[model samples]
Every structure is written in C-alpha cells, then in structure tokens.
Target: MSRYESPRVNAGAAKVVLIVLIVLVVAGLVAASSVKIVDAGTRGVLLHWSAVDLTQPPLEEGLHFVTPFADDVINIEVRTLKYERSTTSASRDLQTVRTTVTVNYHPEKEMIHYLYKNLGLDYENRVIQPAIEETVKQVTANYNAEELITKRPLVKADIQDEITDRLNEFNLATEVISITDFEFSLLFSQAIESKVEAEQKAFKAENDLLRIQVEAQQQEAQAFGIANANIAEAEGEAKAIRIINQALAENPNYLEWFKTRAWDGKLPLVVGEGGTPFIQIPISP
Candidate 1:
C-alpha cells in the first residue's frame, strides 16, 4: 500500500462504484414495477391500452406480475364499504328537505373487470353518486313534508329499492342503506308549528261552544219540571173543591157536621148586627 493516492486510480474506483449504484437502482425500480400486492377484500382489473387479451383472467387478492409500463392493474373493492351523501331536494308539497344518506355497497368481483374497462376509476362519482342522488330526489318528491317525517321508513325503503335496482344494472350490489338525518328549512318548520297551534285553538273553541249549549238545555229542562209540578198542585186543589161541593149537595146537614168537625175547643165572643150576644154553646144530649 502506497501512501501516495493516485488521482487516476481514485477516478477509476469512483466510476466502478457509480456504475454499481446505477445498476442497483435500475434493478430496484424494475422489481417494484414488475410485481403488485392486491389487498384482501379487493380485486384487480388489468388493462393493456387498446388491447384485450381474452386469455388473461381477472386478478384476485395476492401477488401479481406484469410488464412495468405496458400494463396497469387497477384494484376495485369487493367488500362492503360505506358511502354517505348529503343533498337537498323538494318534497311533494314543494318544501325543501335536506337528507343525509349512507349506503353500504361493493362491486361484483367477476363483474368489476368489466366496470373498470367501461367506467374507469371514476365509477363512484360518475355512476354510484349520481344514481343515489337521482333516486333520493325521485322518492322524496312522492311524500309531503309532514308525511316525510311520519313515514320516514317508507321513504327510505323506496329510495333504497330504486337505487338498488339501478346499481344492479351497473353490476354493483347493495347491502344496506340508512338515512342519517333529515332537516327542513326553518321557515317551513315554523309554518307547521303555527298551523298546529291554530288547529288546537279552534278545537278548544268548538268544545267550549258545545259545553254552553248543554248547560242551556239543562236549565230549560229544570224550568219545565217546575212548571209541571205547580200545574199538578193547582189541579189537585180544584178537584178537592169539586168533591166537597158534591158532598154538600148530597146532604144539606153535612155542612153543619163539617163545621162542627172543623171547630177548635176555644170560642171567640162576637157581636151580631142586632148588638145581641152572638155566642152559641153546643150541649151534648
């Protein structure tokens, strides 16, 4: 080993090292581009620009190899995934309603290859989202604002059914759909409240009128009862007088007998028109 380091020697060593480094870098990139790892719950679609090799089957989860730039493997989800959308639409009564909807869905594993070839990577925005929006609007339009609140489950079912049918045509399967929340404009809610209040007040007024009518009828019935009782008493008194007259006609001495029966033990002294003693004492024979 010489302590005198040669510049030419150092240059040769540097060249050799640089070449090795370049080869290593090239090898790494080629290796990376050659193989791909598809995750579980996902399927892959292969594309070779403008060429469909019918023999190449769809790729399942695991490792795969392909030409670096000539081919591309796009992964499509095959497992259930949630998508949420919030949109505003009009009800049957033309009230604006805001709804948040969630859908759990997945592309068909065997059919996703066709989807990738046709729809490309923008399937969610181009197909699924638009389908959901259209179905939501269509279903919401069938129900009034109050019915939308009261029959929320029915509304959701109709929406989901429409969406599921539409997505099925595009080779997508729906697992579930949930409506997270529903909101209406502040003005509409206030209007509903005002209407309800007015109806309640009207109902109360009607009840009050019915109660007053019933009380009036009760008073009239009471007055009629009192009049009937007074008439009966007068009739009984007249009948009694008629009977006494008849008895007197039957026997003239009956009057004296009646007077004697009616007299009390005490007698009052009286003056007659002749100014003589009017007192008459009855003696028992």
Candidate 2:
C-alpha cells in the first residue's frame, strides 16, 4: 500500500509542473501582446498588419498598448516648427538683392502620412524654398527700387499671399511667414536715397510756389477793393459840386439876397447929412 501511494504522489507532482509551464507560456504571450510608449507633445498612429486602424484616433501621451507583434506605430510631433531661408537674386533693373525669410509650420495630423509620402523631411528644400524664390523674384520684377524701399509692407504681403496660396494647393498648412531682413548694393541704395530726397525737395518747392501765388492773389484783391472805394468817393463829391453850381447858375437873385442878409448882420452906427435917416424895422416883414 505505501509503494502504490508513492507513485500517485509523483503523478500529482508532474501535473503541477505541466500547469506551471502552461501559465508561463500564457504570461509570455500577454507581455508580447501589450507594450508601447508615447512621448510628450506627440501622438502615435497605429497600424495592424500594415492596415490603419481608425477606431482609435492617435494615442495620447504616456504609455499605450496594442497587439505588439502585429501592429506598427508611427510617432508624430504636435509642436510648431520654424524654417528660415536666406536667398539672393536679381531685380528687374538687374540689381542684386539679398532677402531672408522665416516661416512657422506644422504637419496636419490627419495628413501626416500623405506628407511623408509625397514630400519627405526635405520638403522645404523641394517646395518651400523654390516657391519663395520664384514668388519673390516675380514680385521684385514688378516693382522698382523706390517701391521696394517705400512700399515694403505691400510687397511682403503680396509675396506671403502668393506663397500661401500655392502651399495650400499642395495641402500644407502655414502658421506664419515673415520677411526677416534684406540687403542691397551700396550704389543702388545710395541712388534710391538720392532720388527720394529729390522728390521730397520738389514737392516742398511746389508748395512754396503755390503759397506765394495765393498771397499775391489776396494782395491784388485788396488793392482792387481800395481803388474801387476811392473812385466811388470821388464821384460822390463831384456830383455834390455839380448840383451846387447848377443851383447858382439858375438863380441870379441869390447873390442880392445874400448881400442884403449880410448887410443887416453888419453894424456901423455912422451917418451922412444928405443920406436918409437910418431906422430900425421892428417886427415888420
């Protein structure tokens, strides 16, 4: 009976070993099935057996899981990126100009795969730089040196708009574009400056001439007013003189009346013997 019990105990030990091996295999499978990590400010796009799975939008930050051996993961940055280009070209007037530009951009998450496929990491070299150069050249060809210096903002806007339109057609998103700096030949700069100064001087001289003309007009108007007033006053005086002369010529008795009035007002109190006695009239007309 003891010997039979010993064999049964060994059989139970074998069963326990087999169960441990099975558990170990299951644990290994589980570990291999689930394992992934996502970095900060990044997202992971998962593909199962080379086919994309849209059920989950991109995996968020921190650790994540998938069918480890069967799934492929792509990590994409979700941060803004900056690109700068400094290029030189010839203007319409055959002048050399150097321009520096900076752009802020980022990939559209949904279109990252497309971007990766169509334009790789060198997309700026293949697309943006050429586009910038072409557009700038076109705009610069349309404007002269004076316009470039004076209308810088307008020119910048035109270039930005044109580039933005072209990039949008290619499905790339743009955040900001800035013209950083520019350089012109010393001779060209001096010439433009001189031209601008001459224009300003001409404008000032024209304004001075206009002011002088206005002052002259005002003086002439004042002089004409004074002459007209003097003429009117002289005509009035002449008319009064003519009326008095006409009255004197029409009535000769005016002189006798004048003399009689004058004689009564005068006094001499002396009389001669042959002369009639002088009498004073009292209240008789």
Candidate 3:
C-alpha cells in the first residue's frame, strides 16, 4: 500500500477503536444504572419515575434488575436500629420530669415500600422520636414524679407499650425499649431526701421508745418481786415470835429453866447496895 493509503487506514482503525470504546462505556453506564443490590438486613423499594411502586413487594437482599433511566431502587434497612431521646414532661401531680429513653426497632420488611412512601428515610426523626416523646409525656402524666423514679420498671413498660403501639401505625416493629434515666426537679429531689431522712428518724425514735418501755416493765416486775419477798419474810418472822411467846406463856417454869440454862456460875467481888450476887439459884418449885 502507498504511504498515504497506509495513514488513512491507520486513521480509520483508530476511529473504529474510539467508537468501540464509547459504546462499551455507554453499555457499562446502562448496566450500572439497571442493576441494584439490596444488602443484608435491608429491603429494596422500587421507584418508577420517582414514584413508589406500591403494586410490587419489597425486593429481598441480593442482586436485582431494573429498567435503566426509568426506575430506581431505594434500600431501606430492616435491621434493628437504636433510637435515643431525652424528653421533658409533666406528671399527674403536675411535677416536671425529664426522661431519657432508648428504643430498638426495625422497619417491617414487607411494609418497607409503604414506610418509605409515607415517612421516607428520616422515619426515625419523623415518627420514632416524636412517638417516644409523646408516649413518654402521655404515660408520665399517669404517674407522679416520685412514682416515675420508684416504679421505674413499670414506667418503662408503660412507655414502651405506648411507643410500640404508636410506631406500629407507621409499619415499624419495636424490639426493645429502655429507660436510661429519670430526672426530677432539684426541689423535688431535695424533698424526697428530706422525707426519707424524717422517716428514718421516726423509725429510730419508735424503736428507742419500745426499748425504754421494755426496760421499765422489767424494772417494775423486779421491784414487785422484791416487795413480795420482804413481806413474806416479815410475816414468817412474826409467826415465829408468836409461837415462842405462846411456849413461854404456857409454862412459867419453862421461863425459869431457860434463865438457869442461860446463866454462868460466877460471883461479883464488889456488889452495889441494891445489887444481888451474879450467881442466882432458883428457889425449889
């Protein structure tokens, strides 16, 4: 071939190569647009021309095909998700209460399309957070601020049930709910502390009073026993003296014999004028 012809052929071949590259790139773009991947724990919602396709069920996890440039797949997570919020509300006793709550939830796989259509990707904010806030307020109003703290499990259950029921209206499933914290006003907290202190003091006082009463009763019983013993001893001594006197009265000679037995044989060296000798012999009876 002539040199000129060779250049034209080379240029032609280059043009063909460029065209093939363009076609391949366009095909790749189309393929990429037509294919969708729904990840694990997620479901795909198809949008036809920017509108949700309600007639179709959500696509399960894995690869899916769609019409290029006319359809789109929006992946919605159906796995359990955590939502935490701090809210303030009023109790039945009109006390302000602050509560922090955490909820675990997931979108219903079958209802993802409807969920996306209604609430969009920000469902946690639009539905869950508001639901938790409202539910907390509503349930808190049914109890006093003290009860909210003391009966924490019951409060958590009430709030959970309310939130679950509310979120269910949006096609969301609740897995678990937790009440992380409950806060009362400073004044209320101080009041509770004071009340507890007072109760403790009262209990201590009552115990002390009982102890004192028991001690008093024991002392009274001891005194009564001592008095009874003294009285019984006095009566026994009096009875003995009466018996001895009766014996002496019944026999005058008995008295003389007692005196003789009691006397020692002795004489005084100097006797007083009106005194007799210490040794006295009783006259023969």
Candidate 4:
C-alpha cells in the first residue's frame, strides 16, 4: 500500500480492457461465421430450417450470407465424376466372365434438390453404383462370352442406355457409360483362343485348295488351247502338201527345188517307193 497507491484502480482498468477484447472477439466470430464463400467449380444448396428452395436454384460461386443459427449451406460438385466398377458375372451361355465398367456422371443442377431430397448425400454409393451393377448384370446375362468380347461396344451402349434411363428417374445425370475390359476364366479363354486359331487355319486351307484348283484348271485350259492350235496348223500344212503334190504330178520339173527343200538339207538314204528321186553325181577331175 505504501509503494503502490490504489491497487484497486489498476485492477479495474485491467478488467475493463479484458472485457473489451472479449466483446471484439465474439463480434468477429459472429461476422465470420455468418459469411460463406462458394468457390468456382462448385455450387451451394441453401436451405432455411432444412427446407430447400427449388425455385431459386443453388447459388453460383460467390460470397453469401445467412443467419448463422437458422440457415445452412451444402456444397455440391457440378463437374463430371468417374466411377469404375469391376464385377464377375455369368453370361447366357453360363460362362463366368469378369468385367470392368466405367461410368461418367454428374448431378443435374436443376434437379439437385430433388436428388438430395430423394436419394440423399450418398447417392453414388447407394443409387448410382447399384444401378450400374444391376444394369451390367442384366445386359451381360443376355449376351454370350464371345459377344461380350467381339460386340463389347454395342453391349456398352446398351448398358449405358439402360442405366441412364433407370437413373434418370432418380434425377441423376449421366454422361457416358462404357465397358472397358471383359476377362473370362483362364481355361475358357484359352479354349476360345484355340478355337479361333483352328477356324482361321481352316479358312486358310480352304483358300489354298481353291487357288490350287484354279491353277490346275488354268493349266488344263492352256494345254487344250495348245492342242487345238497344233491340230489346225497340221491340217493347213497337209492341205498345202496335197496341193504341191498335185502340182508336182502336173509338172514334174517344177517340183525339183521344192523336193530338195522337202528333204530339209538331208538326202534320203533310200528312195521312197514309187517316188521320183533327185540325186545328181558330179564328175571329179
């Protein structure tokens, strides 16, 4: 008391400053809590006392304010989302096939409230995933393993169409749905591969047989053409020989050079029976 006069006054001043700081902090908290920021690539669903306003739609990216105690904000992603599912199921042929499917989807902004109200927050886990699985099962059940592999594109389209139609009733927006891979049992797959190889080999063998048959026919035709040509040539030559023989008989001297040429540069060792001979001997000095 002697050294520090009025300890009570100092205590009161400290209490006053503490009260002011507390008030400032409470006010700051209220203000900060009331203001909410919606970022790009997202939308906010506003509800008053848990009642959504469908007419106004979700607020776009910006700052918004509401009574902190009375209102709430639900942020939803408006962009595309991908879901991959792998499942093993049976085909119409009772063959078990493992399949992987991809689905692209997003919530319709206009129908967001309906989806949230009906299917709730876990729609992907609940509605979309189950719908995809069921649709895939149904589609695969109608097709065989070979069709699943060869006509997969068409199968995917059918699956997408069916799933989309089913989910649309629940207010989900679907972009694209496709089957990426179809895997069968190891033994079954090997069997199919072997069968395909055998079919291809059979086709090649048939083609080879056809080609060989065609070649043989072509050779036969060529041989026949050559035989006919030779026959015609021989007949023409024979007619010419007959005419020449008649000329030789009509004028024997006229046929001397012709007869010499007919010997083809080699005199006959023996004369023909009943035929004139043309051999001349020259005297040597």
Rank by TM-score, descending?
4, 3, 2, 1
Each candidate structure's TM-score, on Cα atoms with residue i matched to residue i, is: 0.57, 0.65, 0.71, 0.81
- Model 2 Cα lDDT, one tens digit per residue, 1-285: 998999999999999999999999988887766777777776677768866666656777687778867886667675777878887877667788888878787666665555544665577788888888888888887777666767899988988898888777655677898888878899988887898899999999999999999999999999999999999999999998897678779987655555466566544476446663343323436
Q: Which sections of candidate 2 miss by over 4 Å?
A: 1-43, 47-64, 69-72, 78-81, 120-126, 150-154, 250-285
Q: Give the alpha carbon lDDT tens digit for every residue of 14-61 in model 3.
A: 999999999999999999999999998899999999999999999999
Ordered from best to worst lDDT, the candidate numbers read 3, 1, 4, 2
C-alpha-based local distance difference test score of model 1: 0.85
The prediction achieving the highest lDDT against the true structure is 3
- Which residue runs of candidate 4 sit more than 4 Å off their true CA positions? 1-16, 257-285
**What is the Cα-based lDDT of residue 2 in candidate 2?**
98
| Error in Å for residue 37 of model 1 | 1.6
List, residue by residue over 165-279, the lDDT tens digit for candidate 4.
Answer: 9888887788988788888999889999999999999999999999999999999999999999999999999999999889889997756555455655565577656763445
Instruction: Report every candidate's CA lDDT.
Output: 0.85, 0.77, 0.91, 0.83
lDDT of 2: 0.77
The list of candidate 3 runs beyond 4 A from truth reads 1-4, 210-285
